[model samples]
Target: MAGTGICCASLEEPIALMKMGLSMVLIGHVNFLLGALVHGVVLRHINLHKQARAMEYAISNVVALTSGLVGIVVGILAIVLSKNKKSKGLTWSLFTVSLTAALMAAASAIGLSVITNECPFDPTRIYSTTLILWVPLIVTCVIQMVFSARCFAVCISFLGLPCCPNRKRTRPYGRAINVVRPLKGSRPISQY
Candidate 1:
C-alpha cells in the first residue's frame, strides 16, 4: 500500500503522469479491443453446454468494454489537465472516474475468472481456445484496474484538492525565526 502510494506520488511529476495517462489510454484501448474480440468471436462459437457460462462471460466482457471506454476518456482528460496544477475539482473528478473504472475492471476480472474456472477442460480442449483468447482480456482488465487505482492514489495523496482537508501542521505555535548574520567585525548580540 505504501509502495503504491509512493509510485502514484512519483507520477505527479510534470511529464510522468502525462506519460502514465498516455499509457492508460493505450491499456484502455487494449482492454476495449480484447473485450470486443472475445464478445464477437469467442462467445459466438461457445458450446451449448456452456451457454450459460458463456453468457455470463459475455456480460462481463461488455462491462470490461464499457469500463475501458470510460478509462480512455479519463486518461485523455488526465493527460490534458496534468499541466494545470490547481484544478483540484477536476482532479477529484478524474479520481472518481478512475476509482469507478477500477472497481468495474476488478469485478469483470473476478466474474471472468469464476466463469472460466467453472468450465471444465475436456479432451478436445474446445474451451482452451476460448481461454487462450480470454487470458489477454483478463490480464488487460487487471492491468487497467491497477492503473486506475494508481491514478486514484495520486489524486488523493498528491493533489491538495479542496474536497479533501489538508494535513494539520505539527506545530501550531510560533513561526520559524529568521536568523540575522552579524557583520564580519561586529560583536554577536547577547541573548538573555
Candidate 2:
C-alpha cells in the first residue's frame, strides 16, 4: 500500500477483496450450471437424431464450461491469498486467469450468436430454446467481465503500475517527448 497509487486504494482493502472473491465464485458457479444446461440441450438434440445446430453452440458451451472452472479455481485462490499478504506474482496470476475467463465468455457469446444466425431454422424450436437459455449466459458473462476489470485495477495497485491514461511520462515542460534527435543536429520536426 505504501508505493501503490490512490486509485485502487479501496480495492486493496481486505474486505473488498474478499467480497470480490466471493462474487467471482458465485458467478463461476452460475456459469457452470448454465453451461451444463445448454450443453445438455445440445446433447439431447443429438440423441434425437437432429443435426447439431451448426456445432457452434457446442463449441462455445464447452469453452464456457472450461472458463467457469477456471473462474472457480481463481476465485478460491483469491480468497485464500487475500487472507494473507499476497505476492505480486500470485496477484497477477489471478488477474490473468480472471481476464481470460472474461475473454472466453465474450467468445462464447459470439459463438452462440453465430450458431443462431448461421444455422438454418429448425421446425422443432431447438434454436429458440438454446437462444432463450443463452440470454442468462450473456448476462453472467458481462458480470464476469466487470469483475475481471476490477481485478485488473487491483493488480495495477498491487504491482505499483502506473494508471492507464497516465502511463506516459512527461518532459520538463509537461508534454511527452516521442521523437529522437542528435545532440549536435537541429531539433526533430516531430518534437515541435
Candidate 3:
C-alpha cells in the first residue's frame, strides 16, 4: 500500500479480486478434470526429437506450464489484496495476469490447431494420444477471458466513476448541496 497507487479507502475494492479468484478456480477445475488426456505420455520420450509429435507435445507442455506459473502469481496477488485490510487497484493486477494467461492460451491453441491438422494422428500408425483436454481447455480459456474482463468492468462500475450525476455531494468543510432551489413554503431559501 505504500508504493502502490491504489487507495483502498473504500469498501468495494476487493470485489474484482474475488471474481478473479473464481476465474482461477474454474481454470484449476478444468485442468484437474481433464488430466487424463495427458496422463499417458511418458517423460523420457518428450525429447526424442525423432517424432513429429514432439513439437505438439512441447507446445502443450509449454501452455500448461505457463498457465500454472501465471496462475500462481495471480492467486498470490488476489489473495494478498483481498485479505489485506487496505488494498487499492487490485483489479489492475488481476487484469494483467488474466490478460496474459488468455493471450498465452490463445497462442497455444493456434499452434495446437496447426499440429492437429498437419499430423495424421492414428493410434495404429503412430502412438497418438487422445486430445480430450482440447475442448475443456479452450472453453475455460474463453470463460477466463470473460471473467477477467468482468472483474474490470465491475471495478469500474462500482468505484471508478459516477454512473450518473450526483447532486447532493458533500466536501470536507462544506455541506452537500443537491437541491439548487428551496422547497416552496417549507423553509426559507437561506436555510436550504
For model 1 the local lDDT of residue 47 reads: 63
Kindly list the per-residue Cα lDDT of model 1 for residues 54-143, writing each as its tens digit: 567667878989988987976886787678756877788888898998999998888777754566335255576667767888898898
lDDT values, one for every candidate:
0.76, 0.69, 0.51
TM-scores, all candidates, are 0.72, 0.69, 0.53
List residue ranges in candidate 1 displaced over 4 A.
1-9, 46-50, 116-126, 158-192
Give the count of colliding residue pairs in each prediction: 0, 0, 0
Clashing pairs in 1: none
Question: Which model is ahead, 1 or 3, in terms of lDDT?
Answer: 1
lDDT of 1 at 4: 50
The TM-score-based order of candidates, best leading, equals 1, 2, 3
The candidate maximizing TM-score is 1
Best by lDDT: 1
Quality of model 2 by C-alpha lDDT: 0.69
The C-alpha RMSD in Å for every predicted model, in order, reads: 5.3, 10.0, 9.1
Question: What is candidate 2's TM-score against the reference?
Answer: 0.69
> Which is superior by TM-score, 1 or 3?
1
